[model samples]
Target: MTEIEKHQYDVVVIGAGGSGLRAAIAAHEAGAKTAIVCKSLLGKAHTVMAEGGIAAAMGNRWPEDNWEVHFRDTMRGGKMLNNWRMAQLHAQEAPERVQELEDWGALFDRTDDGLISQRDFGGHRYARLAHVGDRTGLEMIRTLQQRAVALGIDVFMECTVTDLFKDGSGAISGAFAYWRETGTFLAFEAPSVVLATGGIGKSFKVTSNSWEYTGDGHALALRAGAALINMEFVQFHPTGMVWPPSVKGLLVTESVRGDGGVLKNSDGERFMFNHIPEFFKAETADTIEEADRWYDDKKNNRRPPELLPRDEVARAINAEIKAGRGSPHGGVFLDIASRRTPEFIHKRLPSMYHQFKELADVDITKEPMEIGPTCHYVMGGVEVDPDTELSAVPGLYAVGECSGGMHGSNRLGGNSLSDLIVFGKRAGEAAAERASSLTERSGVPDDVLAEAEAEALAPFDSKGAENAYTIQADLQQTMNDLVGIIRKADELELSLKEIEALKERAAHLHVDGGRAYNPGWHLSIDIHNMLLVSECIAKAALTREESRGGHTRDDFPGPDPEWGAKNLVLTLNDARDGVDLVEKPLPIMPDELKTFFEDK
Candidate 1:
């Protein structure tokens, strides 16, 4: 029998990104003996890759900007499919959270009057993102890390939790994890478990997500009897590096367009105007002159069509590419060189300028960037209560990118950062409270621990000749090709069949070498998570016969009101081998909140 390590905590928060750190802080402050378990070293989470800024209705740039307007914009941006309560709470509380971060020493860029400055982003009615130049995520992480350290929060770095354990009553008891360095099995015994693990982007071939994003939290939630909502809505960001094959799919921040960059086709025409949807025609500028003037005089002119929601823009770029007007590299050109000066570009977008110059050998100050859509974020995740961020499963809380319903069918840029802090704090506080109410921490059964250990070591014992890396690569390719940004029923069905075959291959995966520092062993485990979540996405896409936000069915080609009124929920099947999906009605918004959408 392999010896297993054990630890006890009032609350155990998984993942160490923006949401995890924030949740740990909130839980610690709420008097819970908290421990944060992360897959990477502290401060190296995917949160650092976020470049645009944090969204909050601070009214720093425009006094007319407030939570009401922010809420309206969020609902509209999500195509009104958002969980009304979650959207309402996020908009109302984001300003306070931003101020809290600043109070905890996050130094945001300031206006001329020394107030925290705001910048424009897609789908927002006002300039509302609080930034630290282009490295806003880095700054936020640094500040949060400093606060977490000061609070004396416990952190277990480079630890991966493979499965969530439940007690006899079906409540979360603990989690089974392993250290990456030594591959030692460990169990966390806690009354409350908060999953702050981020998105499931690594399931796709071309994505901005790192290796750590293998849908671990989502899979854990599903297996633990929690439901996942909106699994089909995957966000393919409008701008990503398309040249220099080695650097393909790297993110190009929306801050570029937010500042002044324009999208052009091979004919050197600003084509976003021609692709504006009817829903946004009243608010988007149709002419080049009006759009240019709107940058300086927003009160008089409508915003540019280039600033349309990400789904629309990504589809427009896709349309332009298919029509043979794409750039030489099979992408469209994003020209900031012609719109802004060298000094302005460097001052406002130093990271982008450096990224292009270093990675793709293209200087943004003098030339255009070849850019296209790349899988960025998933709108679907573990379903949770709006106020507490607690899932249907007791003692299990979820926040950040791992939790669903907050973004609805689509997520607006910058809202992700705000969602992290707002709901991170909420989940942390709620988790701590739940822990305090429990008489004692639930114990991980000896049999459960042994079973988990055997499962983890199965790859080493397998005699089958299957490579984990090959299976993972094939799965990524399958998802990218068949169930990508544009989906069709026939393709989705084929993708499901492909996923089923990959799952069979994954079961026979064999890893070589000792467990210590074995990357192959780690990937073999992650492949299970990727395969599970990818099936949920493909399954949900096939069931929903309409286009909305991030989920676009090419066969359907447009949004259907009947489908818009429902959300697809995925839960673990009885056998625990596959997922079962069901449609549920969307939560209704109150009359007061509904008034915001009446005129628009």
Candidate 2:
């Protein structure tokens, strides 16, 4: 038996992104001993990759904007598939959360009146994103990191949690993990565990997400008997670098379009104007002149077609490329130089300007950018209570991208940042309370610990037949090709068969080299989680049978009224061999809140 180092805490947070930091802080403030375990160094999580900004109805850019209007926009943007309570709470709390970040030393761009300046993003009704150029996420993460350090929260960096342990009563006891640096097995015995781990974007070939996003938290919750909802809705951002094959899926922040960039095609036509759907007909501008004017007068004028919800824009871009109107590199053109001044472009989108100039050799201030749709965010995750962020499993909580029902069928741009803080704090507080309220400390049985340890070391003892990288590449290709933005029943069924075969391959996946700092060993673990998540997505997409939000079924090309009334909730079957998606009615919206849509 290999000896494992063990530590104890009242609350343990997995992931060091925005949500994890905030959760740790909240747990500490609630008078609990808190620890954060992350797979990367502090401040290096994917939160820093966010280029757009935080969404908040601060009424800074448009004074008419408030929580109610923001709520309406969010619910509308989600195609009414959202959990009404979560959407309401998020809309009501996001402004205060943004203000709290500013109070904690986040330096956002300022307006002339000394207020945090806001920017427009797709699906937002107003200029609701508080940002610092195109690097808003960097500022937000830095501020949270400093605050977490000052509060004295213990951080175990470069530690990957492989399994979650449960007590005799089926409650969370702690987690089994290994240090990524030395590959030393370890255990964390905590009464409460908060999973702030992000999404599963890495499962797809073309993705704007980083390596850390492999659905670890989602799989952890599922294996621990938690339900996942809305697994079919995966956001495909409309703008990712396409020309340079090396930086293929690098994100091009929507701030570029928010700051007056327009979408064009090979013929230099502003193609977005020609792709407006009836769903947003009343809200989006159909002409170039109107769109340009809306930037100056957002309250009175309609938004541009380029500012439609991400699902709408991504589909339009895909249609354009398929129609042979794409750029030389198989993408549409995003032209900011033709609309905005060079000084303005450099000042407002400094990071974007440099990213294009240094990487693609295209001067964004003087020319256009070539971009295409890329898998960005998964709107589905472990289903949790809207108020407490508690999963069905006692002592287990989730927030941010790891938790489901917040964004529903589609997540609007800029909403992800706010979702992190709003629920992170709630989950942390709840977790701390749950931990402290326990009458007795729980312990994991020795057999469970031994099993987890053996599973973690299995790759080393494998026959060395299957390469982890090859399996991962095959899985990514299968997902990207069959279960992409547009889906079909035949492809979805094929994806399921492929997933079953991949699972078998993953079972015997082999790794070379010692465990210490071994990339191959790490990938072997990540691929299993990715495979599970991909299977869930494929299963749910096939069950939906209709096109809606981020999930588009090519055979059923329009949103069905019947499907719109229910959400697909996924759970592990009795034998735990596969996922079962059950259709559940949408939570009824309260009459007062439903009035917001009466006018629309």
Candidate 3:
């Protein structure tokens, strides 16, 4: 038998990323003894690598900009598939959250008035993203990390949570985890658990997320009987490195465009103008005159061509790259050198400049950077009430990139940071309030604990049957091949077969190493979650027969009105199986929205 270990906390938070840290602090402040368990050092979660700014209506640039406008922008940016309540709540609370960060010692870039500055980003109507230059996520994560430490919350670094412990009545009481350094099993008992584990980019071959993003929270929450929604709409950021195949998938920040960069094909033709829709065409500039005019005029008749929604821009770039109009690197160029001074470029986008210089040996201050689409964020995750952020399972809570129904179809460029702050606090508060009500320890079910242990050890017993590296590579290749930017029914069917075979093989995979921070051993376990998540995404993609937001199908081809009105939900159809896709109606905009206009 595997060694058994147990521990307790008032609240056990899985993942020490930005959202997890935020949740722990909130839980601690709510008078719960909270503990944060993570897969890395306390401050090194992928959140620190976020390049764009946090979306907020701080009104530093324009006093007229408010939460209502922020809400409208988010709705339209998401192509109107957003849960309006969550959107509304996120926009309204974001300003306070940004200020809350400042109070916790976050020093955002300042405007002439000595207030936090905002920047223009795709999907947002105004320059409303409060930023710390371009490394806003790093600032946000570090600020929150400091506060979490100051609050005296217990942090378990280098710990991987393998299982969630539930009581006899099916309530989650704690979790089962592992120490990466020593390869030891540790169990955590808490009245409540919050899963803030981020996006699932590692599921694909080419992605912007780090290896940590293997859908751990999605898998854990589902195992604990929670409902996950919208696992289908993974956002493919329009930019990523493209040279060395090993790092071709790292994210290229959107700030390059916001700082006046333009997408150019190998022939040097700007491509975004061709894709703007007729309804937004008048509002969106296709010509240089209009593009220049809109930027200068606040209530301009035309929208800046450079500020096109992320989906439109990404699709346009994809088409250009596919038609053999791409640069030598199978990607397009994002040119910023001609638009700004070297000093300004370095000051505003220091990390981006440094990343390219170090990683790709290209200096952005001189040459245009190469970029292509890469899977970055998942808009679909476990469903929760917009107000409370609680999942279908009573004791289970999800936030950050793990929780879903907030970003509708395609997430807007800068909304993810705000999504983390707004909902992270709500989930923390709700989980704490729920934990407070449970005055006594309900017994942690041993069977559930044992099941988790069994799954974790399957790789050890099966010797030389399969390779972890090969399974992961094949799984990612399969996802990238079939479930990428463009999809077809037959290709998706083929992909499903590959996923099933990978799972069966994973059951017999072998890792010839001790569990002491063995990436191969850990990856063997992470593959299970990725496979589960990939199936839901592919299945949901196959079910939705039309083009809408991030989900585009070549066979069905166009957006269907019926499909537009509903959200795709994934949950357990049976206690024995994993996930099943179902459709739920999206909330209609009230009579006021037509006049108010999203992103107004």
Candidate 4:
């Protein structure tokens, strides 16, 4: 039997990114004894990699901008697949959250009139993203981390939770975890658990997400009897490094395009104008003259087709590349040098300037960048109530990238940072309230702990022929090739079959060396979560049968009105052997709110 260390908290928050840190702070303020557990160091979360800005309708750049326009834009961006309540709440509260961050000492870039400076982003009617140049996420995370530390919140760093335990009544009891450094077993006893474990991007080979994004929260929620919605919707950001094989999938921030950059092909043609879909035709500029003019006066002129939602841009880029109009590296060109001055480029995008200079040895000040699509975020995750962030499991809550419905089929560029603060705070408040109401912490059953220990130790016992890294690599390649931005039923089905085979290989995975700081052993567990999430995505993609948002189907080709009215929900089968998916009607939009789309 493994020796198990035990700890108790009123609420246990998993993943210490922007959302988890904000959640911990909120839970503490609500008088809950909260602890945050993470798989990495305190400041190294994926949120720190965010380069654009946080979307909040502060109206600093334009007086006409407000929450109503923001809300309408969010819904439209999502293709009307978003949870109405979540979109409403996010738009209503994001400004207050941004102001609160400022109150907490975050130094945002200021406008000429001394208000927080705002920038333009796709699917937004106004310059609504408050930023600190191109390092908005770094500043946001730093501010939240400092605030949480000042609140004296407890954080368990370099720890990974393997299993979420439940009480006799099926409410969340606690979790089974292990230290990444030592692989020692431990248990968390809490009445409530907040999962902010981020996205599932690590499932794909080409991704901007870090290794920690292995879909732990999505798998954990499903195993604990919670539902997952919109699993088919995975965002493939249009711009990623395509040169210098070493850093192929690293992100080239959308801030480049947001700040007057233009997209061109090998033929020196602006191809985005030719690929504009009917869905956004009315709002997008078709001519170069109109696109350039829109950058200066957005209210009077339509947005550039290059600034379309990420899905449209990604697909258009992929098509351009396939048609043999790509750059030297099989990707389209993003030119900012000819558009903006060197001084302005350095002042606004210092990180991007340094990234290309050091990594690819290409100076953006002089030439265009070769960029292609990269899997960036999963719009689907654990389904939760829009107001409380509570999943079907009563005491289990989810927020940020780990939770579904906020972004629906596709997420807007700057909305992710805003989602973190808005829903993170809501999840924390609701979780703390639930935790305080519980009479006592639920006990972890001895049998459950024993089973978890056995499973975690099984990889060490296997000296089998299967290599964990090889299996993981194959899995990533399979997802990237078959179930990526462009999808087909045959490919999705093939991907599912490949996933099953990989799962069998993962079960027999073997590793060498002691349990102390073993990377192989950690990967052995991570593979399971990755496979489960990948299966969900492929299966859901196969079933959707329509092209919409981030999920584009080659077979189905276009969106269907019937499909737009429903959401696909996935839940664990009763026998716990497989997943079962069902379609549910979308929440009805009120007549008043529906008026926003009346013109369309």
Candidate 5:
């Protein structure tokens, strides 16, 4: 048996992103011994990749913007599939959370009136995103990190958690992890575990997410007997760099469009005007003059089609590219040079300027950018209680992108940061309360640890094993080609068969080197998570026969009223190797909240 190092904490947070840091801070402040375990170094979590801004209704730029308005926009943006309570709570608490960040020493851009500046984003009725130019997420992380350090929170960096253990009563006991540097096994015995691990974008070939986002939290929750919801809804951001294969899926911040950039085709035609769906016709401008005017006089005119929700924009871009109006690089053009001056572009979008100039040799001040949709965020994850952020599994919690029901079908730009702080704090408080209630810490049985150790070391003992990279590449290609932004029943069915085959291949994965600093070994473990989560996504997509936000089925072609009233929930089957899908009715919205959508 392999000896394992052990430690104990009241609460363990698995991830170091904005949500994890915030949760650790909340747990520590609540007098719980909290530890944050992450696969990467501190401050290098995927949240730093967010370049747009944080969505919060501070009413800094528009006094009419309040929680009610924000909530309405959120529900509408998600295509009315959001959990009403979560949306209401998020809208009500986001402002205070943003203010708390400022009090904790984070700086944000200010308006002419000396208030925190707000910017325009798709699906928002008013300019509501509080940002620090194009690096709001970076500033948010710096502030959260400083606060956590000041509070003396414990953080285990460069550690990967592979399995979560449960006590005899079916409550969370602790987590089994390995150090990335030496692959030494360690275990934490904690009453409460918070899974703040982010999304599953890395499963796709062209994505904006980094390698760390391999569905760790989702798969962990599933394996631990927790249910998952909304696995079918995956967001594809409409603006990823298309030229230069090295940076093919790199994100082009929506801030570019919020700051006056427009999308055009190879013929220099603003094509978004031609693709406005009937659902948004009342709020979207039909002509260029009206669309351009709305940027300045938002009160009197409708929003531009260029600023529609990400789902609409991505589909439109795909349609244009397929119709042969795309740029030379098989994408459309995003133009800001003709709209904004060079100095203004430099001040407002410095990162974008540098990213394009250094990587693609494109100057935003003089030329357009070739961009297309790239796999971004997954709206599906561990099903959690809206208030406590607790999953179905006792003593386990989930937040940020790893928890479902907050954003129903699609998440709006900027909402992700707010979701982190708002629910991060809630989950932390709940986790601490649960920890305090437990009289004695649970212990992991020796046999469980031994089984985990054997599983971890299986790659070395397999005969006629396949290469991990080949299986991963095949999985990515399958997901990208068949289960991408546009899906069909036939393709989704095909994807499941392919995923099953890959799972078989992954079981016999062979790594050539010892675990110490071995990228192949790390991938071998991570591929299991990606495969499990991918199966859930494919299965749910095939079951839900409708086209909605973030989930478009070519066979259905449009949203179904029956499907809109229900959400698909997934759980581990009896065999414990596959997921079983069931439909649950959508949460009922109260009368007061329903009033906001009466006329619309």
Candidate 6:
């Protein structure tokens, strides 16, 4: 056997998406020789899939819109379960971060006065999202990628991290990874590691996320001795294509509604009015005329039906479909085609139009779009203090969807973009600073290296006749059936059992390729990440017996204040078969932002 080659760096970033790119850039700016390793090509990380816009309180459209109001909306929309500090910091810094993107050559849509244009979104108190029509994520990522290349940060594309290396004291050391193009293992010995590996949307059957979003960062951190918090709260995007099984469950951008689309059922009736939460009731219009009037005159009133948070909207849609009010296409009608000219609609949501055309063979310009909820974002991840982005483990960090607490229970549309920018930079800065303070005199532990090597080669060596594809299919179906939009104790228990069985099957999974650019082998490895993350979500779901945010349990139909006051913690058990769930105390906000939570 050939010896594994090891290289040293100040910091290693384990993703190349929006947060990973931004984190790598920040580490480099902090005087660290940083490198980014990801599972896809440069500029192709799932960040490119975000179609809506970035939430920022730039006040370009309305001067009264500021970070304070943004913070209030975020906390209230999330039902006040958000970390007050992270929310405050995000609202305060997002404007500057957005401006920085502008300085880096990101071309957001412009207002009449030449400042960045803003758009209305669900759960927002005002028009706070800075956008580039649609394709905002593509614009942001492209800009960041350009900046990262210019900074000369080493980028290893199409690489996936198997595990994080830790020393005797259990502090994070670095990571071990293999090249997808070549079957070579290279050890990255960095004092600090930042995991910007995104979310676990792939754990479900219907999802807007791509193949790369398998919660790799959370899995890596958990194995390396970090804790994941609030894994129960998984966001289901309310608007995804729901017809033609092939394109079913793919996200249809919420930006369609932001641009003035409306939702209708089979009988051609607007239904969001029947499901408006009490929180938005004060601002919501009671009638269709009122909703339309509120839409036309945003300054005077509010559009409650169109303004529900993702969790509420998704649940509402699910209820409608279950009641047989769904359109013939197994979804509700998103009627934008009749609301505006095709030219204007295309300008606002170019990719949505193109995606529907190519995948569903429908033109959004002339037809009402069919949409339903799909697993979208996760609000649970590596536990961190809102300001530092540091996990419980030293020298470890997390950002983006993989690191949670920013969105609280429910994530507002558009906030994820700015959340990535704000916290991604924080993690990079903190990791670089932490690395600067530490000495890398001691090398990687022997057991850690041995375990990593075994993991890296096991797929090739396994001749047990298990198919990774078959196992992966079962996993997705299991998660979808047991842990989907509506949950119950019996279903969650079965989901855990099914995950354990699937994981057992994974050990014997045999790949057909020799690792050199072998997608099959890559998937075999990725399934481990998916299994671990799905378990985390399952175990956390089993523990939290309440209907709050994204975690709605049918058995426990009401939101309990006692359950609401804590974070769900998932720690790895002995066999790594599953995680141990615990209810940890939620962080008390600093004095300045306490009122923003809307506490009575």
CA lDDT of each candidate?
0.93, 0.92, 0.83, 0.92, 0.93, 0.87
Tens digits of per-residue lDDT for model 2, 357-450:
9999999988999999999999989989999999999999999898999898999999999999999999999999998898899876677788
Better of 4 and 6 by TM-score: 4
438-485 in candidate 6: lDDT tens per residue? 755458866668778888789888878888788888999999999999
> Please, what are the lDDT tens digits per residue for candidate 5 over residues 281-381?
99899989988888767766488888899999999999999999999998999999999999999999999999999999999999999999999999988
Off by over 4 Å in 6: 445-448, 590-592, 597-600
Local distance difference test, candidate 3: 0.83
lDDT measured at residue 535 in model 2 versus the true structure, 0 to 100: 92
Task: For candidate 2, give the lDDT of residue 98.
Answer: 96
The residue pairs found clashing in candidate 6 are none
How good is model 3 by TM-score? 0.96
Per model, how many backbone clashes are there? 0, 0, 4, 0, 0, 0
For residue 521, give model 3's deviation from the true position in Å: 1.1
lDDT by residue for model 3 (568-592), tens: 8877558544577778888777776
Give the alpha carbon lDDT tens digit for every residue of 1-600 in model 1: 588999999899999899999999999999999999999899998887788899999999999999999999998889988999999999999999999999999988899999999999999989999999999999989999999999999999999999888888889889999999999989999989999999999999889999999999999999899999999999999999998888788999999999989999999999998999999999998899899998867876488887888999999998999999999998999999998999999998999989999998899999999999999999999999999999989999999999999988889999999999999999999999999998755698899999999999999999888998999899999999999989999999999999999999988989999989999999999999999999999999999999999999989999999998998999999999999999999998889888898777
TM-scores of all predicted structures = 0.99, 0.99, 0.96, 0.99, 0.99, 0.97
Clashes by residue pair, model 5:
none
* lDDT tens per residue, model 4, 126-159: 8899999899999999999999999899999999
Residue pairs clashing in model 1 are: none
Q: What stretches of model 5 exceed 4 Å from their correct place?
A: none
What lDDT is obtained when candidate 5 is compared to the true structure? 0.93
Q: Candidate 2 — what's its lDDT?
A: 0.92
lDDT of 6 at 493: 95
Superposed by TM-score, candidate 6 places the C-alpha of residue 327 at a distance from the truth, in angstroms, of 1.8
What value does the lDDT take at residue 516 in candidate 4?
Answer: 93
